[model samples]
Target: MEGIIARRVIPSDNSCLFNAVGYVMDHDKTKAPELRQVIAATVASDPAKYSQAFLGKINEEYCAWILDSEKWGGAIELAILADYYEREIAAYDIQTTRCDLYGQDRKYAERVMLIYDGLHYDALVMSPFEGAPEEFDQTIFAVQKDRTIGAVESLALNFARDQQRKRSFTDTANFTLRCGVCQIGVVGQKEAVEHAQATGHVNFQEYR
Candidate 1:
């Protein structure tokens, strides 16, 4: 089993995904906007292939919104990047220890770590650095022992089960809230509605 050598914390200011990918590819976090442009352009170039069902309700304006540095990115954007860069993207949902892989069918799959915790994105690079930092913060989850794909296979299944539990418990309002402004999960509708009332964030989508 391989060990993690270094972890880079991308700012959680909505551009975390682009920033993380930029850091992983070029070691330059400042290039986030450039990466964003690449993604937006990739999608904009072929809206027929990328929009509608794939983009959900985001629509054509999503391409424009994604160009903004304050916009958040997700699986859709990750898949676009995987196709554009022709590399495998391994996104780990740390909250449930679930791993989502993209671009597996590519002839070459250059692995890049995307550490996610429902809302933010960070990156972890494997061993062999010239002068790597010895210390890592809580944002990092360095491997402590040998791990195989089998060891983590249950995580996604467990996450699904947990979601099922939540769905079963809440019969009155069987839905989850995704913030329109920041694209973060806001738990139940009560909290989401309350948050909107308190913060004037009226835009939200209910996901089952």
Candidate 2:
């Protein structure tokens, strides 16, 4: 019988991407520090390929930035981790309901799924039943298994759509946030960015 694809929500401690990747790769969620080091080392080893032009920051700065646990990881981090692990990372977006496949061209032998809700990342797993334990979860799928891939993709899309309908995503553009450092309120991503830039306060909590 086929299994059910579900989202394994990672923590919101700003290391969701790394934690999600860790969970799918090793069933271990506390590997963010190690993964961050891996990405930093990889970038340091390939200065030309991961140059400031590509990374939007100097190679050394990018490496240091990634090492900070508060820094969020995105496509660059996903691509680097995909190459490092030699597996395809398929990220499904809740807002767009689109699956962005990293390392898809490399034809990696294994693939893992992740759910992205604008600001956060979560792992996707297949379970024997609707509420099975994490020990019974299957996070990796064979890349060449067309039938299984199709089923997984369909389920991922459905899950994304369901999340979208429920407004389970953060509207970063217009969300209200309070700076964790100064208890100052900001409206939307623009104001938040401005506040962070001016005060160097990176911690923020969303409020209704």
Best by lDDT: 2
Q: Name the regions of candidate 1 deviating beyond 4 angstroms.
A: 1-5, 127-131, 134-208
What would the TM-score be for candidate 2 when compared with the true structure?
A: 0.95
Alpha-carbon lDDT, every model: 0.63, 0.92
Per-residue lDDT of model 2, residues 118-185, tens digit only: 88999999989998999999998887645237567788789889999998888888889999999999
62: Cα error in model 2, Å: 0.9
Indicate the TM-score of model 1.
0.63
Query: Per-residue error at 133 for model 2, in Å?
Result: 0.6
